[model samples]
Target chain A: DTAVSQTPKYLVTQMGNDKSIKCEQNLGHDTMYWYKQDSKKFLKIMFSYNNKELIINETVPNRFSPKSPDKAHLNLHINSLELGDSAVYFCASSQGTGPLGYEQYFGPGTRLTVT
Target chain B: SQQGEEDPQALSIQEGENATMNCSYKTSINNLQWYRQNSGRGLVHLILIRSNEREKHSGRLRVTLDTSKKSSSLLITASRAADTASYFCARRNAGGTSYGKLTFGQGTILTVHP
Candidate 1:
């Protein structure tokens, strides 16, 4: 079974539209995170949630939001999608927070294309 | 706004050769981790070295950390064609409410030829 899985492996939309990507983990991790990989292959963290509670929120735009209804699920919702939003979004999960020797398991990634 | 930067953005090597990628970060860190990503896929965790530790080894992979210099290196020995991928270094910052948060480097693209 896949440890971390993301739905809608590919998404294409126009500007001013809203979209959501779903993520789930079977690792029973307590923490989940969302990361964006730009065309330049730079991976950056956008948000992090611990046990369904929002924790780390980077300097991402307010149009982007993350919701974790339960520990096993974390979803990203983007509003007013802009062309700059075209990139790969990755979802990851870990056992605990910080120095716990817990390695993060990543999903296959969702390629979002905004026109 | 990036904390880590990898050197030699790309590398090419023959089978059975060794490949080394270096990573440097600006802030103090609790640990440094290495990850590998194939084309159009998620990252795979390779190994992690704690700030207090100087070196670590796993199979054909070796990692060394220099806390004073805030740098780390990943050495892959006997690389094969299948080893071709992008390698990244991630750092866990020392001080922050975001303890588990990871800051990743630009990543080094490795091409191994048989």
Candidate 2:
């Protein structure tokens, strides 16, 4: 069974368009996260939600928003997609929000290409 | 800001040889973890060492931590071609407000040639 999964594995869109990526986890974890990997291969955390509550919000632009419908699902929506928005986005989940929660299971990642 | 920086950004080794990667972090951490990522894939957790622990081993992987120096090392013995991937070191911040947030390092790309 896949513990974590993401939909729309590859997305190619033009500038000024809007897109959304969905993530789901079956690991019975309470926390979910979104990370962005740029062309330079730099992985950075964008947002984190615990039990459907926003917990950590990084220095991301206002165009990006994350929504969690439940404890098991977190989705990312990007508006006015720019060329710089083209990057791989990974969704992760953990059991809790503590030190033991450090071990996160990541999905295969959704690659977004903006033209 | 990125908290960890991995040394030797890329490495190429022959099959059956051992590979080592180093990581250094800037702040206090509750624990440090190692993850491996195949091309165009998400990261997979390898191992984690707590602030109180010094060293640990799992299968052919060995991890050593130096809290004083704020650095760590990951060693893979008898690496196979399948071991070729990007290795990253991540840290769980010791701050109370930063729950479940992992700051990842710039990864080390390893290529094991068969």
Candidate 3:
């Protein structure tokens, strides 16, 4: 069984198309996050959700939105995608906020390709 | 966001040799974590060392943390081809505002010759 999973491991679409990626974690986590990894293998945080509330959004474009219906699922939806949007998007989850102990569980990133 | 840097961007060693990768961060952190990413795959959590703790070990892996230096290091003993992958260190800041968000380093690519 996968601890964290994402649908459509690879997505290819035209520059103007809209697309979405889904993520779920069976580990019973309380927090979920979205990160984008560029071509240079640089991963940066895009969004973070904790207990169904948006907590952190790091200067991500308005075209990209993240939704967390429940603690176990977080989805990313992009409107009017662009070539620059082509990157591997990763979903991660953690049991709770940490100072003593906590580590994240990551999904098998969705590789998005914008033509 | 960029937390800091990982030195020796690339590392190479023989199957039986040991491999070491170092990471440094800028601000204070509650804990430091190490992750491994194989080619075309997701990242896997390897180990974590808290700011208060100095060293931790799991099987063949050893992680050392130095809060004073704002640095951490991962050591793989008796490495194998299976250990060849990109290793990244992430910082988990302390406080409620962190929201469990991790700031990851650039990463170190390790290649173990079989």
Candidate 4:
């Protein structure tokens, strides 16, 4: 079984479209994170949720929203997508918040392209 | 909001050779982690070295952390062509709102030729 998985590994959409990416982890983790990798391959944290509670939110655009209905799942929704939104999005998870929680498990990324 | 700065940015080596990548940060950290990302794939955790720990080894991967210099390094012994990938180091602040958050480095692209 996959420890972490993301649906629709590749997504292509047009500008102004709305889309969502779903993430799930079967590792019984309490914390999950979302990261975006730009064309330059620079990875940055977009949001983090611990026990379904938002903990950290980077300076992302208002159009981007993260929702965690449960500790095992985190989803990203983008409204009115722009061409600049084309990049690889990754979902990650950890045991929880603490010193021993630094190690993270990542799922296969979702390659999103806004045409 | 501190990010790790990886050195060389890119590296190339032959099979059986060793590859080393360095990461330097601007602030103190509770722990440092190394992750490897294959082309068009998600990142996989490799090693984690805490502030209290100087060095750690797993399989052929060795990681060293130097808090005084705010830097850490990853060394892969006997590299193989399959080891070609991008490596990144992430740092966690000791205490702050971003405690559980990880600040990643730009990454080091390593090419190992057979």
Lowest summed lDDT over 10 consecutive residues: which window, candidate 1 chain A? A95-104
iRMSD, model 4, in Å:
1.4
List the DockQ of the predictions in order.
0.72, 0.80, 0.77, 0.72
Alpha-carbon shift of residue A12 in model 2 (angstroms): 0.3
Give the TM-score between model 2's chain B and the true chain B: 0.96
The residue ranges of model 1 lying beyond 4 angstroms of the native Cα positions read: none
My TM-score estimates for the predictions, one after another, are: 0.97, 0.97, 0.97, 0.97
Best by the DockQ measure: 2
Of the true interface contacts, each candidate retains a share of 0.66, 0.79, 0.74, 0.66
How far residue B101's Cα lies from its native spot in candidate 3, in Å, is 1.0
Error of 4 at B49 (Å): 0.5
Residue pairs of candidate 2 with colliding backbone atoms: none
Candidate 4 local lDDT, residue A89: 96
* lDDT of candidate 3 over B22-110, digit per residue (tens): 99988888899999999888899999888889999999999999998888999999999999999999998776677778889999999
lDDT of 2 by residue, B82-106 (tens): 9999999999878778978898998
lDDT for each residue of candidate 3 in A1-115, tens digit (9 for 90 to 100): 8599999899999999999999999999999999999987888899999899998899999999999999999999999999999999999998887566588888999999999
lDDT of 2 at A88: 96
Docking class of 1: medium
- Give the per-residue lDDT digits (tens) of candidate 4, residues B1-114: 357689869999999999999999998888889999999999999998889999999999999999999999999999999999999999887776674888899999999999
* lDDT value, residue B17 of candidate 3: 98
- Model 4 chain B is weakest, by summed lDDT over 10 consecutive residues, at B92-101
